[model samples]
Structure formats: structure tokens, C-alpha cells
Target: MPPKAKSKKKGGNVKSSTVMDGLSTEDMSKDQLEEHIIHLREELDREQEEKSYFQLERDKIQAFWEISKRNLDKTKAELRNRSRERDEAEERHRVEIEVFWTVTGIHATLNFNEIPSTGTGPMAPQHDGTATKWYCG
Candidate 1:
């Protein structure tokens, strides 16, 4: 009610007072005041509608985020389980290798070199699980 507000526009050559949305209550007719009130109410309604739309969008995004977060956690847990399984398999393999070497060492110490080589490698057993050809034993 004090006065109609104006915005100042800056330029190199010309200065001006910018017209803003305001009512000149000093000389306003009754009809004008009513129209102004109606416009303001409509603007307020539009703003409230926009706010509601954004709130709904935010809720949808939050729900998606929660689902994605849960999926990520599940994937991480699966990876951890797989890593543990791999480590346990590696440890078992290491123990098996050690046992194989220890048994071979014992055989060597006991003069158990009973099989003859074929110059290619150790002879393959036949289908009956015996050497296909006899060798020094």
C-alpha cells in the first residue's frame, strides 16, 4: 500500500525503472482491486500445484533409490561369498600339493623308483588300469 515497486535496469547508455507486479492502492477502483486479488489467488494456486507435483516426483525418486541401494548390497554380499569360497579352494589346493610332494619324498627315500619311463613321459595305464607294456619294476 505504500507505493508500487519498480526494478532498476542497468545499461551503458540508458537507465530505467522496470514495472513489476504491483497494485496502486492510492487510486485503485473497486473493480481493479477485486481483479488483482483474483489474479493473486490464481497465481498462488498454480504455485501450490507445482509444489505438489515436485513432491510426488521426489517420492518416486526416493523409492527407486532405495531399491537400487538394496540391489547393490545384495551384489556386494554375493561377491564377498564368492571371494571366501575362492580363498578356501586355494587353501585346499595348497594342502593337497604339499601332501603330494611329501609322499613323493618318502617314496624316493625308500628307493621306490620301480616304474620305467618311456622317454616321452610316464607311461599311461591301459583301460584295465595296468601299464599297456611291461617295464622294469
Candidate 2:
């Protein structure tokens, strides 16, 4: 004859249909419950601290990016203005050279070369045609 199987029952009067189904949840100790609560609190605190630090770092990065953008914009504007001035000056210089050639009537045979005439001074002029005329200031 075979041995009898173990019974799985909830209460003394009730009958369970599955094996190892007679366990009850009224058995946790008070110390175990307190330790679980403390662990959960520590985890929450650590997460909150990390969130605060990340927020501060993000703000600092945003500020630095804004400053860099402003500086770049200012630099671009300055470069644009400087280029315009340089182009205008070059156009004026070209017109002045044409007028000088027309007025001087230095022979077409002459090999035109620039020769600075002014000896020395802050206001000294730069030359381009004959030994006497100065084309640049």
C-alpha cells in the first residue's frame, strides 16, 4: 500500500486543494517591519539628493550656453561691419587711382610702380605713381 499524501488546509475546519497552500501571513516580527521601513526611507532620500544636484548642473550649463551665443552674435556683427568698411575703402582707392592716371597722363610706356615718398611722421603719405604724387594716406 502507498503512504497517504500530506493535506494543505487553511484553517483547522477548512480544506485546501493544493499542496504547500496552508501558509498564513500573520507571522512577520516587529523588528523586521521597522528595518524594511528604514531601508525604504534611505533610498528615497538618496534619490531626492541626486535629483537636486542634476537640476543645479543643468541650470549652470544653460547659462554658459547663453553667454557663448551672445558673444558669438556680437563677434559676427563686428566682422560684418568691418568687412563693409574695408570694401568701401577699396572702392574709393580704385577710383582715386583711375583719376590720378587720367590727370597725370604718365605715358602708357611707363612701367607704373608704387614708391612711398613721405620721409617720416604719423601723417606721412604713401605713393603709387611718380616720385612726387602720393596716392594713399
Candidate 3:
């Protein structure tokens, strides 16, 4: 038999060159390659788990933003409704004041000879639903 082949060192470490020379791409079986792939998959799964925690917090913030937007919209709607009711009440009060002045002027014009005095108004019905009281001279 011929003499055993001598190992050649290319880099500074002779042991690393020897170990690399012993391994070949075709020497590893399919099962060993599959085991490496499974290890890589496990590493990827761990990384995703870490990222999911931050993703959950982002989702919560988004939900809060949506709730805040809805609350703002509801406040705006309520303010608009209250403003409309106030305008209507002011209009009704203006009409009642105008009518009171017109009636007092008519009474004064028709009774120029007599002294003006405060007149009594009709009695209002006493009920829980009707809160108006009768005025006396």
C-alpha cells in the first residue's frame, strides 16, 4: 500500500484546516441537513415571538385611537344639538316679548281717558303637568 496522505495547512491554524478537509458537502446525509433546517426554523419562531409582543401593543394603541376619534365625533354632535335647541328657545322668547308689547300698546291706545293699571290674568289650571301660575293685579 502507498504511504498515507499528508494534510496541508492553508491558514494559520492547522487543526481548523484539518477539520475542514475532513468534511465535504456530499458527505453529510439528508437527515443531517434536515436537522439543520429544523434548528433554523426554531430560531425564526423565537424571533417572531419577540416581535409579537410589540405588535400587540401597537394594536392596542390603534384601538385606543379609534375610540378617541369616536368620542370626539360624539361630542361634536352633542354640541351641535345643544346649539340648535338654544337658538330655537331664543326665537320663542323673542316672539312672546313682541306679543306682550303689542297688546300693552293696543290697551293704552284704546283707553286714553282712563288711568292705566296692571290687569289680572286668567287663572291657570293647577296640575303637575301645567306649571303656570295666575297673575293678580
Candidate 4:
């Protein structure tokens, strides 16, 4: 067996070394080796438990992100549909206004306000003592 190398201790503090640097199992006493193995096993178990917890949290966050993305997509689609409907309604209203103006122009050109009335209905007297003419049509 090789000689044990001297470890450096700062300020007379004894810091326990977890790693065995080039030291064989035969160099350590039975009790020391067993204690080192137990410490290593506990550290490994703690690391594994922490990893599992982080994985669970990551999965939950991923699921929530997916649901939020779907809701956002649905909301965007609804907004687009409403905007298209509003545009169509505006187009219909513009066409209705154009048709109304066209019909009014035609009625004005026909001069339908000056239709002569028959004398069978009652007539009012004018300033000259003549019956006033009334347009009925």
C-alpha cells in the first residue's frame, strides 16, 4: 500500500473530505470507509429526491403553458370572426344608403309632386275669390 498524503487544514479547522483523492480502500480503516460510503449514499439520495421534485414542477408549468396558449388562440380566432362580421354589416349599410339615394333621385326627376286634383273634393277660396288648386298625387 502507498503512504497516505498529508491534507492541508486552514486555520486549524478540520474540514471533512468527501472525495478520496488516489486513496485506496485499504488505506482507510474499516469504520472510516463505512462512514464515507454512508455519507455518499445519503448525498446521492438527496440529489435524486431534489431532481424528482424539480421534474414534477416543470411538468406542471408545461401543462399550464399549453392550456394558456390554447385559450389565447381561441380568443384570437373569436376576435377575427367578430371583426369580419362587423365589416360585412358596414358594407351592407353602405349599399343600403346608396340604394336609398338612387331611389330618391329617381323620384325627384319624375316630378310627382305637381299632380292636378279633381274638383270633386272641397276647395279653399283664394284672395281673388277663386277656388285654390290642390296637388294630391
Candidate 1 residue lDDT tens string, 3-85: 98897767657643323255455456778767777888999999999999999999999999999999999999999999999
lDDT on C-alpha atoms for all candidate structures: 0.66, 0.67, 0.63, 0.68
TM-score against truth, every candidate: 0.56, 0.57, 0.45, 0.57
**Which ranges in model 2 have alpha carbons more than 4 Å from their true place?**
1-27, 107-109, 112-137
List candidate 4 stretches off by more than 4 Å. 1-18, 21-24, 106-137
Residue 40, model 4: Cα distance from true site in angstroms: 1.2
Model 2: per-residue Cα lDDT over 18-112, one tens digit each: 22224222343567556656876999999999999999999999999999999999999999999999989878976877787789985334433
Clashes of 4: 0
Error of 4 at 57 (Å): 1.6
- What are the clashing pairs of model 4? none
Of 1 and 2, the candidate ranking higher by lDDT: 2
The RMSD (Cα, Å) of candidate 4 is 17.0
Ranking by lDDT: 4, 2, 1, 3
Best-performing candidate as measured by lDDT: 4
